[model samples]
Target: MYRVIQFSTGNVGREALRMIIARPDLELVGVHAASPAKIGRDAAELCGLGEPTGITATDDLDALVALGADCVVFTAQAETRPDEALAQMCAFLRAGTDVVATSFVWLVNPRSADAWLLDPLREACEEGGSSLYVNGIDPGYSGDTLALAALSLAGSADRVVIQEVFDYADYDDGEFTGVQFGFGLPADAEPALMATPGIVASIWGGSVHLLAEAMGITLDSVSDRWETWVTPTPIDCVMTKVEANCVAAVRFAAEGFRDGRAVIVVEHVNRLTPAAAPDWAYPPEGRDGVHRVLVEGHPGIEINSHVGGGEISETFAGVVSTAARVVNAIAAVRAADPGILGVVDLPAGYAGRVMS
Candidate 1:
């Protein structure tokens, strides 16, 4: 079994901890609790195992690094503190720990990643002979891997699209949704970061580029677009209360253009309230928390998949699956060459476990 350390105890990290404990090929060695409230608790208390894991959660980053575990399932909140997360990853790498992460999203396409971001990770990997893979549901497997895998069934290719139809009401972190996402903001006010131009492109753009590269297509430029939906009446959402006529959710896309036309695309129709946008496309199952992949080519393909299943909420499904994507990549990352990598760099039909 490969030794493992779960970094953070938040939504995503909690799920990663649980999986590491369950997998026979993996052993839970340590956990880095970001919140002081969880600092001295047993790893089991945070995950839903109903028992002690013998391993305690701590905030001591240096101590965790010193353990020199085989891999660290890093699910820390990298959106707001990317530099700190990058530094932390480097520390783990310099100490010889492979990293399979859902952070520093820009690294999803490490090849085209900005030098300021990619160089340090590369240097760290070289220094300690470790590897790093950044991933998640949207920018992770849902688009890059799963979408590409479906393309093989197509005889010829025209345009490809991955759309996210998710409800954010179960996100649990209301303040995060209210403040960062501005879920209930008025129409005239400044919208959430999610509504900002280029934000979607910044996050999902890498996935778009990865898809373009995989198909041997060169994109002229990548662009983004967005649309907002409002509530007809006050609605209670995970974020603040949405007043009538206030913005409740958004639909956006990051597209890669070639020959003056969009080709590879990643679109999202997200709502803070379940029925906010009826006109936007949703999963054929008419459920939230689903990702749809469409390949417009010879065989014309389409797929709609949900994570965590019907009994589970969309937020739980999305975050937990993000954790699973990286957790399942542990062994593959360990076997990879010492460098910052992605799903494309690894062998196909061979990830998700050390052994089936």
Candidate 2:
């Protein structure tokens, strides 16, 4: 059995924690609760599954590392606290603990990351013989895994595209939806968090390059653009409220070009509500959103899939899958040679225990 450290208590981390405990091959050694209020709580209590797992949650990096787990499932939100996340991961890696994480823009395709950004992690991995893998629904399956798998069956491929069409009404984080994405702002205004120049390319570009690299093609450049729609009148969701004429939906795409022709693309059509972007895309009836993979080749192929069919909501199901993508790979990551590992590096048929 692999000894594991679960970091954070967000939706993703909580799900991963549950997965770790359920798998007989995995043992939960320590938990890192990001929220101070949860620091002293039991692991199961932090994740809200039920009874205690006999493991208490801690926020201290030192305490977590001292437990000497074989791997650390680091699901802390890296979007806002990237520097701190990097430091923590490096600390774990240097302490000889492997890591499997949801997503890290810089490390998704480590080959594309700058020396300054990736070199430290590399050095730590080398010094301590640890490994790191980053993946999730979008950067994980929707693009690198799913899109490439679709293209592999194609006779000949001209283009590959991945899209995430989510109704942010189900996203559930008001500050994230309103402040970071500017969902309730004027159409003329830009999201300070994401609209920074080249940010989209930086975030999704790796997935594009990963597809291209697998197809034996190299991208010359990646370009991006975004558009927004207004609510026309007031609208409300669990996340935030949108006033008349405020932005209610956003559609953005980053295209990777080879020889001046677009070869790979990553796109998102996210709305505050399904009613906000009527023409963009929608989940199948009774669902909240869909991820699409389009491969234009000798025989073009399109695959559209979504989460949530049982008792849970699609958004929450997605959160579960995001955690599962990494959490399920704990065994492969633990056994693999030390250093940074990508989705492509994992062994085939990697999975976790299934409920009976």
Candidate 3:
């Protein structure tokens, strides 16, 4: 069993802790949290593990790393401040602990990180002999791995498209519901303000680009836009201007090409509220989370995947699944090149266990 140290005590950390408890291949070695309320708690208790495992939380960074953990799973707020987070991650890697993080900073572009961030971390990992990686549900899996796996069904294809739609009302995060989707905003608010600049692109762009590269298709052009409107009331008990309750619709499309020939196209949508269309699935009703993968091949094939959604447990599970994949990818940490690494570099059918 791999001894793992988890960073932070937020939703992601808690979710990961739950998976470790059930998986016999991994063990929870320690937990580091900034919250004083969580600092002294057992890792298992945080996830309702039924009994304490004696692995209490700690605020002491040095002491936490000294536990001789095989790896560290970081789900901290570095996503809001990626540069600093990347540097800190490098420290853990250099200390001989393989690093697995879902931080947004490292997810952006491994090369874009500051010299101070990558230099020491790379050296440390090289000397200590370890590896590091960053990932998340949206950019990491639902958007990338699933899409790539579907593409393999066709021997050859001229184009591929992956689409995802999420109901905003089902989401309970204050920041996500209020700002990101413009759910509770006034009816008179401008529609342009509903979609935050770079936020939507940051989430899906990486996946689209990665898939294109893996397919050997050069991306000719990419475009993204957001649409928001006030709903008459709220459909399906949702309340928003974009829809009856408060729904914001955002769509992204990317056209790929090879030598000036269009080879692929990808389009996706993030719906925050309910829609008037009878076909549009709304959360709390029919299938809330649904994904459709369509391949335009010699014979044309399509696969429909229906995923259920409900409660905080489901939300935590989706987010935690991404972290779990990163942890399972830890065995190959040593083979990972210095600097930031993404899911694309990850081996296919990775077994979600040891990296090797």
Candidate 4:
């Protein structure tokens, strides 16, 4: 069994912890908590697993790093603190621990990442002889990996578009839904997170670059476009309330151009409620969400993924899938060559085996 230490217990991190405890091939060695309130708490409690694992959450970084575990599942939020997260990952890597993370989405395709960011990670890998992989559902598997896999059926391709259409009303993250995506704010409020310059490129642009690389084509340039819709009436959801004229829906596209034409595109259509953007794309009947990849070619192909659970909402199921994507890649990452690794570098079929 591979000894594993979990970092943070946020939405994704808690799911990662549940996965670590459930996997027979993985052993939980430690858990790291950023907030003092979480410190000294049992790992099982943090994950809501209803049983004790005897592993307590600690705020001490040095001790967790010194544990010398095989892999550290780093699911800490990176958008708010990219530099700090990068430094923490580097510290763990330099200590000779392989890492699989959902943070640093740009590392989905390391070549597309900034030189400064990539250089230090490369150096850290070389120094510790440990490998690091960054990935998630949209930016990781559903967008890049799955999209690339579907392209194999195409005889000829003109355009590739990967889209994630979600209803955020059921999602519980207030800060993410309201502040980041401008869900509860007015439509005209100073550009929300999705409208920030280069933010879309920084988050989803790597997927565009990854697709272009898979297709063996060079992109002339990358471009982005965004649009927002407001709730015409007051609406309430499990997470937050949206007053009339508040930002309720957003659609954005990040595209990679070849020969002055868009060949690769990553688009997102997120709404607070299903009715908020009735005219926008909707998932299959009875399904809450979908991830789709459309390849415009001689034999155009479209792949749609509908991930839902009986007990949890589709939004939470998406988060669990994101955690599974990274957690399942742990073993492959540990055995891989030392350096910053991308999804393309690892072999196919890292998804964990189902236990009967």
lDDT of each: 0.84, 0.83, 0.62, 0.88
Instruction: Quote model 4's TM-score.
Output: 0.97
Q: What is the TM-score of each candidate against the true structure?
A: 0.95, 0.95, 0.79, 0.97
lDDT of each residue in 203-269, candidate 1, tens digit only = 8898888888778889999999988888888888555678888887788899999999999989988
Residue range with the least summed lDDT across 10 consecutive positions in model 4: 347-356
Candidate with the larger lDDT of 1 and 2: 1
* Model 3 error, position 234 (Å): 4.6
For model 2, residues 1-356, the per-residue Cα lDDT tens digits are: 88999998787888889888888888899999877788788988877778789999888899888888899998888868778988999999999999899747567777777787688899999999999988888767787777877888898888998998888786777776457667889877656577676888888888888888877887788888777788888988887889999988888878999888888989988888778978877767776788889889879899888887678877778889998888888888888899998877887667755543
Candidate 1 lDDT at 341 equals 93
Residue-level lDDT for 174 in candidate 3: 46
Where is model 1 poorest over a 10-residue stretch in terms of lDDT? 347-356
Model 4 spans with C-alpha error above 4 angstroms: 352-356
The clash count for each model shown is: 0, 0, 16, 0
Which wins on lDDT, candidate 1 or candidate 4? Answer: 4
Question: For residues 211-280, could you state the per-residue lDDT of candidate 3 as single tens digits?
Answer: 6765676676544555554455654423233444344454544445456754554454555444533344
Which pairs of residues clash in candidate 2, taking residues 3 or more apart in a chain or in different chains? none
> Which has the greatest lDDT?
4
